[model samples]
Target: MKLIISYKLDSIENVIPEKQIEIIKLFSYSKSDFIVRKIIEACNLKHPNLEKIPAYNILKNNLNEIINNCLDSIAEKRLVNNQFDMAIIEVVIIDNGHTLIMKLKDNGIGLGENYLHKLSYPEFKHTKSQEHFKKKEKDYCIGGCGIGLFHLNAKLAKNDAKLYLKSRKEAGATIEISMKKPY
Candidate 1:
């Protein structure tokens, strides 16, 4: 009887872990797309770093999108062409049948105190609060409605997914997006 019980317990443990679904961790902004690439290969024993983005955005296109997102929080924190700083983006992947998870993180001026609740609506204008959202005056920002996060939330819900974001003013922010397999 004890042997049977032990076997049952073992099977239960395995089943629970197996149902974990997916997990992704992103580290920085400069590594935004890079981290996305990393999630694609997280299952491998050795992961290769590939920045194989199409020539359309020229890598600059992606960064521009991120910069635009940042402005919603900072409003006046865009980096100048000469002011060099990389954003942190990390991704962790867990294979759970029809599910995939992606987490993106950045250590830049995060959403302000009032921005947490607004993350579901994570877009704000620099002029809206007399704050600096973009990097600097010289930095060209990407295009966005400042309502990008809303779209993200909608998509996640469609897949019965979860999106988590943590942020603080002048500190940094983290975002986690999980889906039931979006390829």
Candidate 2:
């Protein structure tokens, strides 16, 4: 149950260095206490941030959503895989002067086709129902409301950010977010 997190940030000149360091440090310190309860072997994070701006708050909130998505992926894997081993999560942050691009990729059982379809629209409700939970009492049930992606999409939209998700059954999934940089 070990989850390794690794990240890369390109072109630091585009972001506020102090904010970037603070955010990464926060993640490194609190990752061990994540609700997923997984061991982390090696984790590296890099990103740029805006200093003393509402943009930082917006991005910070969005980052929390990103973490939720990662946790959801882990929960899905635990439910489907017989023997869930280690998982590696790779995050990339790119600063293009005007925008910040973030991509999160993970090695786990990918999304089901039906699930992926549900994610295409923000209004779609796709969580596993309580009835399904009742049947899964003896099975692995991580208790997800299935609103992670929907909420993520909404968050991105509020910040004029764009999101792209690519998932294949049994293969892993990747989530990419692009947003204008905060001044």
Candidate 3:
């Protein structure tokens, strides 16, 4: 069986580069630590102010949305191909409490160097994911509004927090979120 995922990407294609830089810069100045439960909790909050203002407070209100949204996209695409699997979204603290890193992984479609071209530095904007879903493609999906990641990138756009992504063509994809120093 063959699968085709089709959608217009011109609008978002320009966002990758600018978004990448902003996200990394935001992470540069950290001083925040997010517990797994908070990550889960913040996902439910509709507001962008995920964390209350205070020193040493880890703010990641929309993390779950970002990860879950990505998963939803993955699942949608899989459905088109009649494939199924759980996309594990994990937040791992790599260094001491001073540094934070998150990993959103999926055993779905792996991103290649070619896919890298689509990345852009994120910015605050209104985006719609439904566009990526094309009726002509069964194994394809229109991801959530780009705002999820863009907000994440902008929110983390301090002190060099970096968002990295890796994809293995037929394997899947993994997104790494890391910040250099915490407040």
Candidate 4:
């Protein structure tokens, strides 16, 4: 699947401070299950027939995991002061007759070089350092067992989809998933 148009994360000036705070609060304070429900609801509203699509369960799970990972990254950056005052997560979906593409961009502490290497394999668990895990902060930012991307990649493959990841150490990350439409 060729990505024709790439949308970057919104510029700092374009992000509203109030909305940013609201998003941070929501992610930082709210339960992840609650957040997932909200995300699924939004997706359902946008694609009412999503449940009828082939590999619907896989698609839905992929979307939720990807979004949760993005949110967790943003929350971590906020904790480490690596994120800007206004954080942003931009999700774009496009259906161009033959393929369905979903791209998620976030202004968070991007993946480091070490983490990038582990991301290549589905079996390898990508985890943060001991210090990060020791932090006694909000549960939302703590993230999972470092298997989300691995699972995401495996699931995408099941649906004949591909996952592309691009990131800069301190800048941000962009994840794109594309699969052929089942006609």
Candidate 5:
């Protein structure tokens, strides 16, 4: 797949540049160490001191959703098309002493045209999966109940997080979450 992942480091005003880079680098390193490391390394280009923060679990969940739900869906689609179309994932972070914000942008097929509206409702649910995804990878499986985002959002909300999602059919999607730092 023609996938490119990039980081917007300049927008992080409150965090020191070195620390911002460190955090971003940590995120990239996580991608490399993901379950599908080879596929990630093949399709993507070669890409934190917060060892024991309370938000670590939350961050891990977010990473899981980003990979299993977001990027995996894109990869599955590519398998069906038998070609790699262009896709981009951009991560932007803003950290101040009081609050932290992370935004992700992806050019992969978005959460469908009406997903955002449905997501606004408390009872929203949907699953987009393909059989090819299961057959292509031994370590991965296809099928989801579509509750990952809901659970993640709920957890974030309980932590006083603010989330914004903008998505479209062909235009891709942007997800931004802002929350307080637990330090």
Candidate 6:
């Protein structure tokens, strides 16, 4: 029942088109802020205050949504005793000046085939199941609204970015976001 999060930020010169970067997964939820701060620093924004920057806010909010989704998926899988002792979330950020690519992988219960298909739509829909609602009360469900991904995609679209998601039931999920640098 431990959460291990890790991330790697590749330098612009070191980045290869399809090169696979290795990330050593270690750390906990409490250290997530440090990881994020490292990513912001890697962006090399000239602004004195990151919070006041639009791109910074967008990136931070998107990351938070993805991380929360991973946590929720892990929690649900844990309820069914389908998850391992350690839940890992590995993030890779590749910034090459023009483009910013973020890849987040999680060891958690993944989206079902039906649910994944539904995600293609542009409307609001509940991604959770009735069993989920019954087990975790509606008020207690952390991400029951199921609009996080929708909003994430909309925000990305506004910034001329794209989102790609891949998942296998009971295995895990990978969310990749490719956006232009500096929003």
Number of the top TM-score candidate: 4
Candidate 1, residues 53-108: lDDT per residue as tens digits? Answer: 12111222333344336433332233322222433333344445554444455544
lDDT of 3 by residue, 90-151 (tens): 44434344554556665654544564434444443433223444456754544444455555
In candidate 6, stretches whose alpha carbon ends up further than 4 angstroms from where it belongs are 1-35, 45-56, 134-145
List the candidate numbers ranked by TM-score, top first: 4, 6, 2, 5, 3, 1
**TM-score list, all predictions:** 0.47, 0.62, 0.51, 0.68, 0.57, 0.66
Task: State the TM-score for model 6.
Answer: 0.66
The candidate 6 region of ten consecutive residues with least summed lDDT is: 18-27
> lDDT per prediction?
0.41, 0.57, 0.46, 0.64, 0.55, 0.63
lDDT of 2 by residue, 10-128 (tens): 33335447766655555445642442222111111323234333433554555655565565566567566653554557666566778766677776566655676676574777645
By the TM-score metric, which is better: model 3 or model 5?
Answer: 5
The residue ranges of model 4 lying beyond 4 angstroms of the native Cα positions read: 1-28, 31-49, 82-84, 127-141
Better model by lDDT: candidate 2 vs candidate 6: 6
Query: Which ten-residue region of model 1 has the weakest summed lDDT?
Result: 1-10
Off by over 4 Å in 2: 1-56, 120-122, 127-134, 143-145
Off by over 4 Å in 3: 1-59, 96-98, 110-112, 121-142, 145-147
With a 3 Å backbone cut-off (N, CA, C), the pairs that clash in candidate 4 are none
Name the candidate, 2 or 4, with the larger TM-score value. 4
- What would you estimate as the lDDT of candidate 1? 0.41
Model 1: lDDT of residue 16: 38
- The residue-level lDDT of candidate 3 at 168 comes to 64
Question: For residues 5-37, could you state the per-residue lDDT of candidate 4 as single tens digits?
Answer: 111123533544655655544555552444456
**Model 3, residue 164: displacement in angstroms?**
1.2
